[model samples]
Target: MKLVVRVKLLPTPVQAAALEATLHACNQAATWAAGVAFEENARRPLELRKHAYAEVRVRWGLGAQAAQHAIKKSCDAYTTLKANLRNGRYGRPGTKRHARASGKPVVFRPEAAQPYDDRMLSWQHQARTVSIWTTAGRLKGVRFTGQAEQVEVLAAHRQGESDLVCQGGKWFLIATCEIPEGDLNTHPDGFLGVDLGIVNIAATSDGARHCGRRINRKREQDRKLRSKLQKKNTKSAKRRAKKYAGKEARRAKDINHKISKRIVAEAERTGRGIALETLTGIRERARLRKPQRTTLHSWPFAQLGSFIAYKAKRAGVPVVYVDPAYTSQECSKCHHIARGNRPAQAVFSCRVCGFVEHADHNASHNIAHRGWYVWVCGAQSTAPGLTLIA
Candidate 1:
């Protein structure tokens, strides 16, 4: 079990400039590589585009590793765009604008150049410090540290593993350390089920539920602010809009981290295996509904599930993803299935058997029951006090 923790880096103006320069250079290299591929495809063949990149890199004097990184990143972007074009995931490539249109083009940061031990530092000291290299000298300086910030070094990469990324600027790297996996302990008899939803962040079988808390309020406020900002069309309004957008993103991510930590702690206390719903093809299904589209899209189901899985693995607890079909519609008590079973959003009442419970709790119970079935089948362990409803 392994985890990567990210902390912020506070760089001096000079260091910031250098870092930005590196990013710009990488992006330029990627753009050039893409152009070469496109030109070669017109004259020769698409399959021979690799040679075009090699020729471009040589002309540009890019080092072997840097050129390789840039080419690979560009190729990946091209592949994704091609797939999206073929699958109709987005409007035809030329007709619609997407993130790649405005985003800083692909940038490569390889392990060899970004050494872990060489850059590692304590969060307290590192948060304020930036690394800068010049022709004649190097300098490090402390800038500012926010209340929620930390710093540390990340581990060097291993072959065949993609580097961990902090998308949307929510996380920063602090330091890297090696801890013994033996420190984690597991209990075979315990089991826990986690239910993810849009209204509530998560509900567990252990009688603990993490509400969305301020997320709904924040989203509403952000939406109103954005609408107001758009109407103004002033520089100050634009600045405010950017600031609020970043703040809202950070707030949501912080809440997610807290909820995930709480779930992991509960599993540790109960010594239980963790269970979750397998949410495959959920996004596609969500897109089909027009009225409930916002609510469906807002569900952080994947993020919550991923956080729980990694945290549980690090704690040496086994995690299972069971079939999610009918988990919400079926009655947890007698396995009765009907649309009328859930008379309302929050309240669940079984029409067939007259069983009533909270909708989330019922779903969680179903998930837990599924896990229990798996446990029983695998280990043949049964307790005297527990009763199987079916």
Candidate 2:
């Protein structure tokens, strides 16, 4: 498995200015290359490089590799534009988008992203520092922080490229790390079914509920704060809104990580496969009332599902996806599906068999049962204790 792990870079004031200048210079070179490529109809990297190389190096004072990076960036954009034109999605002769603007970034790609060969980038485990290549010069020691476990992975399997990114007054390094596909191990005796809900976050067949009250509270607070800030429309308010937005995103991501860790830990403890409902086209297919619509739109179902999958894979837990259709409305007790079975958001009562349960819990049971149907047909688990579960 290859993971793009984020490492927060702490640069000195002088180093920070240098990095900012290098970034802007690289982006400007890339942008200029894009313009020249369009004007000359340069369709290939080599062609764009030939056209832009002299100007980029002379004007931006970018190193050789940096010049190549900018040209490649421009070539990529032109290639994408040509592809879209060929597919008739955006650009075509005499169409509204025929003269499409190439919105190229001012950052170097390919070469700007340092490869983890000894020359351009290096890692110092003891000092927790990193080396990065910049157009200005090579920065020898940039302090950084990341999840310890992921950093340990970096020590073993750090790949060849990492991108330098700046956001909210901080620099970040996103390094690619690779792990073997066959390294994962799994025990498939039983399975745990997870039902995802906006209000509940997640409810498992094992009777575990990861509540969403606190998450909802934080989201509501942020929403109100942002609304007020936007209304004020002042410099301070704009700054505060931007800061709050980033903080809220981190908080949500942290919650997803924690919740996924717990879910995977449980699956590992029980030696059971993890099961989740497939979320394909869910937002488009489902019709809901106004309040339910708000909750569904705000919910981070896709992010949470992705977190569960990657963490489960890392932990050697088998993950299965089941169809989400009618999982909530189906009664686990009687195998009956009806809209009336769930009278309220959190309350589920079977109309046919008079079976009642917490709505999310019941849905989780249904999902688990459905997933077992998938597992039994395809799974090779022949353990003595392997039994059907609902």
Candidate 3:
């Protein structure tokens, strides 16, 4: 399995200036290359290099490797744009958004992240320092810091390229590391069902509820602050808004990480597989009132699921996705399905069996049962060698 370890860099003022200059030059070169690719209809890195490589080196005063990376970056941007367009992310072909995106050449920001291969960047794990190539020259002894586990991973299993990013005026290098997977648990005793919701972030079949009230309150405050700042429309207000741009996202990500870690650990300790709902088109399917739409859209349910998956993978715990249709309204005890079963957001009462339980918890139990059935069916199929999770 591959993971990214992001470490903060503490560079001197001079070093920072050099890095800023290097980023600006590289991005300018990349933007020019993208324009060339757009005009020439070149999508591949090799093809773009043929048209722009030499010019990029000479025009931007970039070295051979830096020029190649710049060209590759441009090609990668085009590839991403193509994928987004193909998936209808920008809208239909005749729509304004789609036409605007398809008609214009891609542009790179001045401080956009740049990739550094082994030749362009090297690290000293013991010293917690890095030496990297720059437009000014080769800059060395730039200090960095990260968690102990991340540092250890970087020292032992770091591989491939690192990206140099400038966010909120702070420098960070995201290094890739290859970690070996644990042995798979093929014979799981049962499945630990987890139900994700807006009120309670997650509810497990084991009767654990990770509440979202505090986090949601904080998010609402941040949203209100941002709205006020935007309404002010002053330069200082804009700066403040920029400072808080990703604050809510960072908080949500941290919460998701902690929740996923706990969920995975519990599943591994109990020798059970993790079962989650297949929420692929949840946003499209969900209908919400005006007041609740923001909360529904802002919830990071997909991110939480992904975190659980990767953590489970690292722990060799099996994970299965089950259909989420009518899980909440269905009774976990008597298997009675009715629209009136859920009386409130948090209450579930079975009209047929007189069963009462927390809505999310009942749903999780149903998910667990479905997951077990799915696993059994798959195992007994003609292809008995098929594994649920690997």
Candidate 4:
């Protein structure tokens, strides 16, 4: 499994200036290369490099490797743009949104992230410092800090390119670490179903609920603040809004991480596999009122699911996805499906069996049952000579 470990860089004022200049020069060179590629219709890296390499080195005063990276970055930007266009991310071909994206050459910001290969950047884990190339000169002894475990992982398993990122005037290097996965757990005692919702972020079949009330309140407050700032439209207000732009997102990500870690730990301890809903195209199919739409769209259910998946993989815990259709309305006791089963957001009542339970909890039970059925069927199909009875 590949994981990213980020370390904060603490550069001296002189080193910072050099890094800043290098970033600006590289981005300018990349922007120029992209323009050249757009005009000549050269999308391939090698083809664009042929046209932009020499000019980049001479115009930007970059070294051989830096010049190559700059040209490659430009080509990568165009490749990503082309992919997004084909995927209909910007809109249909004749739409104004699509034209706005496809009409112009890609431009790179001055502080855009730049990739550093081994030859251009070297790390000294023992000293917690790095040496990197710059337009001014080769910079040495730039200090960095990170969590103890993260630093250890970076020292042991780091590989490939590291990206130099500047965010909110802080410098960070995102290093890729390739970690080995544990042996797979083929046999599981049972599946621990997780039901995702807007009100409660996650509800486990074991009757555990990771509530999102606090986080949602915090997000609502932030949204109101941002709305006020936008209405003001002053320079200071805009700066404040920019400063707080990702605060809620970071909080949500941290919450998801904690929730996933706990869930994976519990499942592993009990020797149980994790079951989750296959929620693809959920937003497209969901219908909600104006007030509820914001809450629905802002919730990070996908992030929570992905976090659970990767953590489970690391722990050798099996994971399965089950169909989510009618899970909420179906009664876990009698399997009666009806729209009237859910009288409230939090209550589940089966008219046929007179069974009552929490809506999310009942849904999780259904998910676990379906997951068990799927697992048994799959196991039977795979092992024809061996028989396992449910």
Off by over 4 Å in 3: 379-390
Candidate 2 lDDT, 1-390, residue by residue in tens: 666777788899988888888878877888788778767888578888878899999999988777777787777766776677677766657665654433433234422432233455678977999877776788988898877876787778777766677877788777777765433444477788999887899999999999998888778878789889999999999888887767776777788878888998998888788888888888988888886786688777888888787777667777788899998899998889999999999999998999999999999998888777788777532211111010
TM-score: model 1 vs. ground truth: 0.71
RMSD per candidate (Å) reads 8.3, 6.0, 3.8, 5.5
Report the Cα lDDT for residue 157, model 3. Answer: 82
Task: List, in order, the clash count of every candidate structure.
Answer: 12, 2, 0, 0
lDDT score, candidate 1, position 39:
56
Q: Per-residue alpha-carbon lDDT of model 1 for 155-176, expressed as tens digits?
A: 2321122221233332233333
Q: Global lDDT of each model?
A: 0.58, 0.76, 0.89, 0.88
Give candidate 2 regions above 4 Å deviation: 77-119, 181-187, 379-390
lDDT, residue 115, candidate 2? 26
Ranking by TM-score: 3, 4, 2, 1
TM-score-better candidate, 2 vs 3? 3
TM-score of each: 0.71, 0.85, 0.96, 0.95
What is the lDDT, from 0 to 100, of the residue 180 in candidate 4?
74
Model 3 pairs in collision:
none
